[model samples]
Target chain A: MNTNTQTTRLYHSTLSPFCRKVRLVLAEKKIEVELVEEKYWENPPDLKRRNPAGKLPVLRHRGHMLAESQAIVEYLDEVVADPALMPRQPLDRHEVRRLCAWFDDKFNSEVTQPIMNERVWKKITRSGYPDSRAVKDGLRAIKEHIDYLTTLLEARRWLAGNAISLADFTAAAHFSCLDYISDVDWDRSEAVRDWYATIKSRPAFRSVLADQVPGIHPAPHYAELDFG
Target chain B: MNTNTQTTRLYHSTLSPFCRKVRLVLAEKKIEVELVEEKYWENPPDLKRRNPAGKLPVLRHRGHMLAESQAIVEYLDEVVADPALMPRQPLDRHEVRRLCAWFDDKFNSEVTQPIMNERVWKKITRSGYPDSRAVKDGLRAIKEHIDYLTTLLEARRWLAGNAISLADFTAAAHFSCLDYISDVDWDRSEAVRDWYATIKSRPAFRSVLADQVPGIHPAPHYAELDFG
Candidate 1:
């Protein structure tokens, strides 16, 4: 095993929501990390050797190689407990995890994955032209997600509960990716817009807001703290 | 609103891997639960209202409605400490969670979901006939996964580590579903076959081994404890 436990490094892609989620959590906990952009789609041989799953957002921290965004974030929360991203109660923790899944699995399949695959990835990878139908469907599905977030925000201060948890950062991670492309129509729900604005202005969100993907230019308001 | 905190009820589908994972965990913890089969594809109106994500398995435990399989299982482990399913250390816990994601996300997408959607779901829902191409691809994918499991089992007692964890149950849940259909090539790797046999004989696995999805007959050797 490598004995260089002092340095922390993250293998990530700029616009990938999963990567951004890890970056956000790491930043929130005030951990310094060296970011290395990985072109995972090219199927880097070393990636598979290092991580069996061969997925991104792989963190090399304290001599351990960690993969999976949720697992990494939860691990970070456990090891570095200063600003707890998870709640104490099991039931409350369940809520935080449920919403994380909501954004990562459900919302991702419905919105982010489809839209990004068409709008951003295709252009970056030179795979093909955008599929209008897929983009339209993703755009259509996002409205439902935004409305659902409105309902949650109406009842509580944050996405999962009153205290900001990994759920909020998870949701923001996906939204920021879309927002970078100007896909989110912030006008649909003022509550969600305000929530995004508040989260956007945070110190933790600075690195993410400043992201500049080479081929894809971020929207004019992408980095604005007070876009609303 | 639910005064029935005394009764633990799970809304699930018999053949779903996610539902089986929850069932295995609940049984391991000895939590008595009433399983209600949900035909989620029919777009059960109440599923949406009860759980915002509208997915299974949704567990009503201690008066709180819980959704997301990983969230529910982790919650169960947290609330009921007997026969601990997660390791205490942060790194070990990360390994468990990462392996759980391996089976649930990667294995499900590559092997279980495609095979089940083609072979089992299409037959149950009467949507269409089995697509041999999809089934073939899933079958091809399972070999690589089984090989990876073999590599892990060679060094450790269980999938994630020595102690049987949520990783084992999570893996068994998916494998059991596919095994029900006689899809697994038992001869592929002796290590994996032995590992499955060991996990299969556990008392907690009885409920899952006894599951009978309507209109789908299980493979002849599915529930046999000493199949090897």
Candidate 2:
């Protein structure tokens, strides 16, 4: 593997879906990097300087620094020469980005927000009681997003296209976190469920699945579900 | 140019920030296409078929289609080869995406929302009277966002790096809409004020800047402010 494996540092958290997406991309690209776990809540000045938006998953490559998941993925795709995670054509690539944005924006807001906020943020932010209404809303939204995913999976082998792209990694990253809280109904959408199983079983995703978020315990089915 | 040109169609509204971002990208890339102005408030089935999320600025590239401003801009960047709107480095690109997301998510929510809702949405959505409180809040937030951009512009020639990237376009797109309502204080931050002026002067931006939203009239300073 001639991929650039020099002192690339990924400042990420074990539980963040965005960080997990970058980690998955790095693994698939066959690049090795030092993963630095970030305490985003602590409001570290160095991390804040690295990302003014003060979000997780800031990547340091060579001397340049970057702060968004999609941008980081695109940069990785560009800097490395092999195993493309993005498509070559304009439209096909658009489809990949569209799905990636879908997961980042809508799915994160709808499905992941409720579950993560309830299960993780409650323990992390350490504020307010876990409202049942938000939890129910998130659960309901997750089901709908999964149905949409199922529709995509039925027509395409992968989430966005024939081969595994950044889109699949992004979706699985979000769902995996929700799965940690047991918010997702795995049986609800078989096609999407099956697609996720395959993505989870990938060698690239091993570290992400194995990541332990301190006080939280992943749902029991998290380890049992098989993609193969 | 060897880049492939498809039957590109943009489903957009002149007033939407997301749509304006796509329009700016098309201008930078110099891509020619049909612009289908969508009346999103009507909930047209055609628009829903293109984007189930019912969002603005859905780009149709030949057989493939994409929703979300970030995704559509990226596709246009790839398909049209001139004037690259994104940086080559992973980290720099991340900064661009992060800022773009900042504008789309934070600025829009914190600043654009209050202004649009109070100013245009009341009229467009036909809900009720625009809230003065929200309008006042939006005005306050816009100034802060401008200051943030001032810091970024102080260090670099463009928002993300030495050259103009999509980050500038995204910012300008938002401000242009705000400028439509005479909401932005152009003199507050000179650097940001100038940056927006640069984009507004572009031939691609002329059409968008010239757009009239029926009953609204822009301040004279909007078209006159200069960054240089």
Candidate 3:
């Protein structure tokens, strides 16, 4: 077997939530991806060549370019197909996929929007103007999303039912970044908080926590803050 | 034998690209999911309860809730485990996943952004101010995205190469909508245009073509825009 098939090249930024999602999946599958940090905001020609839409966390493997965190992670799970991050049931797997999408789509828009804009993206894109209205709205949106999360965590140990499936990683990926900004009211929703704490403490999560923004300082408790 | 354990429920909208993706997978699998039309825009309590984010195409199977189109479709393939949308090798699987994510994420932003924003979301959200600039930007984004896609299609019969997979379906789902708005410059990429023609003619795609958005008139030749 040609070793080229084993090569996983991920074009991502440490501050990008989507990149972290792919990273966690790689860590889970014990697959090594050569991480290339792309300055997405500056719009590199190489990055645009990899992903025309200019989104972060594009995975190039097996001589193919994979864009979208969901597809990248699922591809990882499929190729590895061991230590499965998803349940075997068709329905159960769907459940995991659904939550992964939720994190990337809805949660990112509502929760991560302001934090990234106010903290990293604004600086990178050099927008220079921070909309206090957007920041306030994002904080409020986080609370609502958290309340919904509370209901889910109330009955299950993980974000998507009982297992440490893709859903948990997806949720944690987004939340970890918000936690960095201290945007997460970790005190609310003890079950969810505890669940996050456990995920944060995982070996896979250490790299995500280690991610730093040049102009942004994580909350003093950011590193030490554990869930629950 | 209790059939409920094997049965599936698809909560979706007839007009949604994400929902149509699930429909394509179901058609491919020949596994039936009781179709549940979800009014994602209405924000019905039940739908919101099932999907706190209030998105469409939530799949419920064997007492589990699956949200997000990418996750739901993969979950379906996983549980069904026949007519695999993924390749046998790990690297090849990554290729498929990457392609799927590409169409769903990048294509959504580039192509579907304008059509959905102009035709559906604007009407639903009642955010009356529609920026022609954004619509123009969306159009421009796709031309570039299509060139990249055309390059990929040059070497492969389908989006992910070789066999029909999630990538093609995801692309078709978005393109079909763009076609509705007469937005795609099909002449720009003969390969992509022909590939789309091939997809829209699939047995599973019949329903999608037949669908009519409430207040929008699809291109006159849309139904007849066939590859064959």
Best by lDDT: 1
Model 3, B1-228: lDDT tens digits are: 234845778888776778888888887778766776766667778987776667787777767776777777777777777888766766666667776777776677666866678766787568786778888888888888898888889999888778888777777777877776678898898888889888777777766677776777778868885533
TM-score of each: 0.98, 0.90, 0.86
Candidate 3 lDDT, A1-228, residue by residue in tens:
225755778889887788888898888777767888888777888876776557788887767877777767776776778778888766667667767777788889887977688866787778897788888888889888888888877788887667788888888888878877778887877777788878888777766777777778887777774534
Model 3: residue A180 alpha-carbon error in angstroms: 1.7
lDDT of 3: 0.77
lDDT of 3 at B134: 81
lDDT of 2 by residue, A104-218 (tens): 8889988787778877888877877788888889988887788888888889999889988999999988988887767778888788778888888888878877877778887
- Report how far off residue A200 is in candidate 2 (Å): 0.8
Chain A accuracy of model 1 expressed as TM-score: 0.97
**Per-residue accuracy of model 1 over B104-205 as CA lDDT, tens digit each:** 999999999999999999988899999999999999999999999999999999988899999999999999999999999989999999999999999999
Question: Which runs in model 2 stand beyond 4 Å of their true positions?
Answer: A1-6, A225-228, B1-8, B30-33, B87-92, B224-228
Q: Global lDDT for candidate 1?
A: 0.94
lDDT at residue B91 of model 1 (Cα atoms): 98
lDDT of 1 by residue, A12-67 (tens): 99999999999999999999988889898898878987788999989998889999
TM-score of chain A of each: 0.97, 0.93, 0.91
* Candidate order, lDDT descending: 1, 2, 3
Error of 3 at A92 (Å): 2.3
